[model samples]
Target: MSRVCELTGKGPITGNNVSHANNRTRRRFLPNLNDVTLMSETLGRTVKLRISAAALRTVDHRGGLDGFMAKARESELSARALKIKKEIEKSLTAA
Candidate 1:
């Protein structure tokens, strides 16, 4: 799988590493991603997602996966996460 955060869309960034001798080297800065399984209260299931550590903290701060998904913008989420968000919304409406 690609090194991308499903929720926050955080990914590797390209940059140059500068040295003391005024030398520059190409480098990539990757996001701190973790494979986590978060439980969805509305759907009554656990969803596995590769997301950034910051996003995980945001989910915790927002009260849960459902709350985070509800508040997150559609453009920021990955395709899979967008689908899960839709399912969560549907379950919420059904409940």
Candidate 2:
């Protein structure tokens, strides 16, 4: 699996590690990705995703998967997440 956050599309960033002796080396700063199962109130199902810790906090703050997906940008979502978002929208509209 990739090291990208499924929710926020956070990926590894390139930087440099500077030594005290004035030496620098290339390094990667990766997002804190975790495998989590978040529940969708509208769909009444849990979806699994690899997301950053910050994204997880945002999800909780936004009031769960449904709320987050409702406000999430389509470009930032992975294919799986986009499908889930569509399903949630369809369910909410059909109700």
lDDT at position 40, candidate 2:
89
Which parts of model 2 are misplaced by more than 4 Å?
A: none
Best by lDDT: 1
Question: Which residue pairs come into collision in candidate 1?
Answer: none
Please write out the lDDT profile of model 1 over residues 7-73, one tens digit for every residue: 9988999999999998999999999999999999889989999999999999999999999998999
Worst-scoring 10-residue span by lDDT in model 2: 39-48
The prediction achieving the highest TM-score against the true structure is 2
Per-residue error (Å), model 2, residue 32: 0.2
Shift of residue 47 alpha carbon in model 2, Å:
0.7
lDDT of each: 0.95, 0.94
Distance from true position, residue 24, model 1, in Å? 0.8
Which lDDT value does model 2 have at 38?
Answer: 91
Report the C-alpha lDDT of model 2 over 65-84, residue by residue, as the tens digit: 99999999999999999999
